[model samples]
Target: LDRNATMKTRLTTLTWRGSASVDPRFSAAMLPWSIADIRNHESYVTLSVGVEDGVLAAYNTDFELQFEHKLRYILGYCRVIVKQEKGKKNADFLMPKATSTRPQPITIGNDNVAEIFGPEFGLVYLLKNPHDPLLHIHFYECEKYEQVGWVSFLIKAMELGKCKPSRH
Candidate 1:
């Protein structure tokens, strides 16, 4: 496991100001190792580019609130796996097939994820075709962590920006 994946990846400092600016608290309180470990799970996803980490919700989307008027649903962990015994090229990444009737797997193409967002906990992942680098999303459930992280991330962004943002 790469250690950086576990640590927080955000930070605020003169050196860090050039990248995208989200809440900096996420970067500050995190131990470097915890952010690093995340790479093995999620954070490797890069599509056409310009995509933010959280998937946007929509109108009547009972999951997240995207618009002031429309309902929004947030996107969570989406992974591609391969199954070893499935007789497919990347069979090992697949979730096991049921011996009898069971809930079917949720497998979607890479480009279509943005269109479909569902209850993160209720979502299921199945086998991926296993390329050298597959996109993965890791959803962390600690709002406390997010609150702390965002606060830290912002604080650092301000300080680094020379705005000298202060919280009391």
Candidate 2:
């Protein structure tokens, strides 16, 4: 194989094995996962419509989708927020424990919230400046996960601050 092809194969090999590192110990309660997929050259990932904390993040970027799997869980959690309040209207997510406008050197504040929409998780952590506001609602041309019994768990998290699915 050519050098580029070899590198691509190696990268895929590494990327495909990423699920091995998922730690069930550390608290992934707050942020589900970082849908940062850098190896996808064919199919694209996407996020549904929703607001995170207070920031208005709604866009599509390739790598963002990789993180979508994680973010989607969070958003799915939000849906739980809505359901738990069934006889209610608005749902408020606890502010983030930290934030940053410059990516690195993340500061501390609830003003920072991230979101993924459209074909991927377009991260927008700052709420004051208002970066992007177009959550391309139709990024995934195909359905990824069936948004069924998944939402209830999120509601359970809102009430408890962490997702604790009742083990049967």
Best candidate, lDDT? 2
RMSD of each: 18.8, 17.3
Off by over 4 Å in 1: 1-73, 86-88, 91-96, 106-168
Model 1, range 1-168, lDDT digits (tens) per residue? 432232223321110001121222332122122223432344322111011122111112122222221001211223222323355343122232335566224334333321112211111111122331332222221112233233223323432463332232
RMSD of model 2, in Å? 17.3
**How displaced is residue 3 in candidate 1, in Å?**
16
Output the worst ten-in-a-row residue range by lDDT, candidate 1.
12-21
TM-score of each: 0.19, 0.19
Please, what is the whole-model Cα lDDT of each candidate in the order they appear? 0.24, 0.25
List ranges where model 2 is wrong by over 4 Å. Answer: 1-21, 26-42, 46-48, 51-110, 114-121, 124-168
